[model samples]
Target: MSWADKPNGNDMARRAGASRSDFDGDFAALRQRGRHLIAEIVRLSRQLTDLQQAIGSRRGAPGRGSVSGGEPR
Candidate 1:
């Protein structure tokens, strides 16, 4: 029978040197890192939204000066 006949046929790479356990460990580490990065992105997005809203409110105020001086566009 061919080596490909087994369930873990494609796992010959492990026999060569790297084991399936090693692959699993690496995958787990990477998954955890990805989760952390996603959380950070979400936090930063909220902060950015808050800053934009604050700026928008200030600009909409009557007293705040516009980029085009005091005159109307």
Candidate 2:
């Protein structure tokens, strides 16, 4: 059966047995939480890119090799 036509509260733990209003509230809360998480991920990705660029610049200079000087440690 379709979503609306199906019985409320399936085998899931959600207010599955609750009314449509309850289900809508739950869905809205989940959507908001997902949006917040996505924003956090984007922020973290920008920070990670900045860190990588900093590392690249630091290592780009010559004579930045290990103290072992190409010989196996």
Candidate 3:
């Protein structure tokens, strides 16, 4: 029939001997890992933003060209 119906029929055929409890446990574990990864990404993004701002401010400060204060060689 249609493409969508093919996959559904295939899934039904595959699940005939599969254990439901095992599938449920695997799904739950995957969901937990996904959430942990998202939190880590947010933390790293904030740290990167803070570091960029610090670098920009340092570069914009006055007397940045003066190393030891004798007109920079």
Top TM-score hit: 2
TM-score-based ranking, best first?
A: 2, 1, 3
Error of 2 at 27 (Å): 0.5
1-73 per-residue lDDT for model 2 (tens digits): 4345644555475554568987687688768878998999999988876766555556662433333234342
Give Cα distance to truth, residue 16, candidate 2, Å. 6.0
Q: For every model shown, what is its TM-score relative to the native structure?
A: 0.60, 0.61, 0.57
- Candidate 3 lDDT, tens digit per residue, 2-62? 2234344247666787698856875686688789889999999888767666655565634
Q: What lDDT does the true structure give each of the candidates?
A: 0.64, 0.63, 0.62
Top candidate when judged by lDDT against the true structure:
1
Tens digit of per-residue lDDT, candidate 1, span 1-73: 5323534736676558877797787668668878998999999988876766665566674543334434343
Could you tell me which residue pairs clash in candidate 2?
9-16
Candidate 1 global lDDT: 0.64
What candidate 1 gets wrong by more than 4 Å, as runs, is 1-15, 61-73
